[model samples]
Target chain A: QQQVRQSPQSLTVWEGETTILNCSYEDSTFDYFPWYRQFPGKSPALLIAISLVSNKKEDGRFTIFFNKREKKLSLHITDSQPGDSATYFCAASVIMGYKLTFGTGTSLLVDP
Target chain B: EAGVTQSPRYAVLQEGQAVSFWCDPISGHDTLYWYQQPRDQGPQLLVYFRDEAVIDNSQLPSDRFSAVRPKGTNSTLKIQSAKQGDTATYLCASSSLGGLNYAEQFFGPGTRLTVL
Candidate 1:
């Protein structure tokens, strides 16, 4: 069973458009949520993350809106640029947990 | 500081063969993890270690897979009698900033394995 799931397997947007990616988790015990970005032929890199204590977290043009009751979260990229094109993964872990569970990735493509 | 490093970037093998991937974590990082990523899919954790002892390896297919970080520095993952389903990119990551959960992990370029 997949503990984490992501929607819109693929997405396309014009530069400067805001794009949203959705994620849901089955494990309510998970308290740490992190987003990772992977470029072609490169390793996955940490982009942003949130804890259960907060409902929203933002960094630069990226924002994450979370709902504890729904076990759902979304990543929004505002003023998207071509360089932002890549695969994004949503991951979760319980506090003090030793590992991360990742969701199926969303591939974002931005047209310049 | 240098990032995580993996060797033998690509490997091709037939079913029933064996192969090993090596990794060297970043300096001063106390935790290491290994993950398997298939095409168009996100990575799945296989195992992890803290110092020279294994922290969790439940996700690893123990019968045919094994890993070791004897010196608490470098590690090796071996697949015995590989199968087609085992084909994927193996990534090694390390972290020290996030405590036990490792809020942020630095990943390696990964070693792609192809089994026929």
Candidate 2:
């Protein structure tokens, strides 16, 4: 069974617009949620993260809105740019372990 | 500080062959992890260690896969007999194990393995 699920296998957004990527999980034990970005032929890099205690986290143009009650979360990118075009993965993990359950990923294409 | 480093960025092997992937984590990082990512799929945890002690490896394919982190700095993942289904990208990540809030994990470029 997939523990984490992401919607919209791919997405295209215009430059300067906002892009949203959604994710849902089946595990209630998940307390730590993180978003990662990956380019072609590269490893996934940490973009942002949030704990269950917080409903939202923002870092500059990136924001993660988490709804722990629904076991869902979404990553919002404001003023999207070409540099934001990449595959995005949402992951959930328990507090006790380093293991992460990842979503299938969303490929974002920001047109300039 | 330098990030996690992995050797042999790419590898091609025939079915039934054997291969090994190596990784050297950032200096002073005590937690290391190995993950397997198939095409269009998310990374799956294969094994992890905390300073030479295995923390979890329940997802590892014990029949043909094995991993070890010796000296708590470097790690090696080996496949006894490669198979076509074994093709995937192997990633290594590291984090400080000290009592800090979950540190952001740093990842290596990863090793792409293609088994024919």
Candidate 3:
């Protein structure tokens, strides 16, 4: 069974617009949620993360809105720029757990 | 500080052949992980070690896959026999043992393996 899932396998947005990526998980024990961004032929890098205690986490133009009740979360990228084009992965894990259960990923493209 | 480094960025093998991938984590990082990512899919944990101890390897295919972090810094993942289904990119990641950012993991460029 897939513990984590992401919607809209691919998305495109105009520069200066906001792009929203959705994610959902089936494991309630998961408390730590992180998002990773990967460029072609490169490794995935951590972009932002949030704990269950917080409903939202914002870093610059990237924001993560989390809903524990629904087991869903969304990443919002404001002022989207062409440089932000990459594949975003949503991952979840239990506190202190060493392994992460990752979603398939959402490929984002920002057209200037 | 330098990031994680992987060797033999690319490898190609025929069925029944064996291959090994190596990883060197950042200095002082006590935890190391190995993950396999098939094309168009997310990375899947294969094994992990904390200071030379295997923490979890339930996802690993023991029949052919083996990994070890002998010195708690460098890790090696070996496959006894290759198969077409084993084609994927193997990634190495590392993190500190204790800190406010312990959950954060830094990854290497990864080794792309193609098995025919």
Residue pairs with clashing backbones, model 2: none
DockQ of each: 0.69, 0.70, 0.72
TM-score of chain A of each: 0.97, 0.97, 0.97
Model 3 chain B scores worst on lDDT over the 10 consecutive residues at B95-104
Per-residue lDDT tens digits for candidate 2, residues B1-116, read 79999988999999999999999999998889999999998899899898999999999999999999878999999998999999999999998847866667789999999999
Residue A46, candidate 1: C-alpha displacement in angstroms? 0.1
Predictions ranked by TM-score, top down?
Answer: 3, 2, 1
Task: Assign candidate 1 its CAPRI class.
Answer: medium
Best candidate according to TM-score: 3
Docking class of 2: medium
Candidate 2 accuracy as lDDT: 0.92
- Answer with 2 or 3, whichever has the higher TM-score: 3
Residues A65-94, candidate 1, lDDT per residue (tens digit)? Answer: 999999999999999999999999999988
Q: How does the DockQ of candidate 1 come out?
A: 0.69
* Interface RMSD for candidates 1 onward, in order: 2.0, 1.6, 1.7
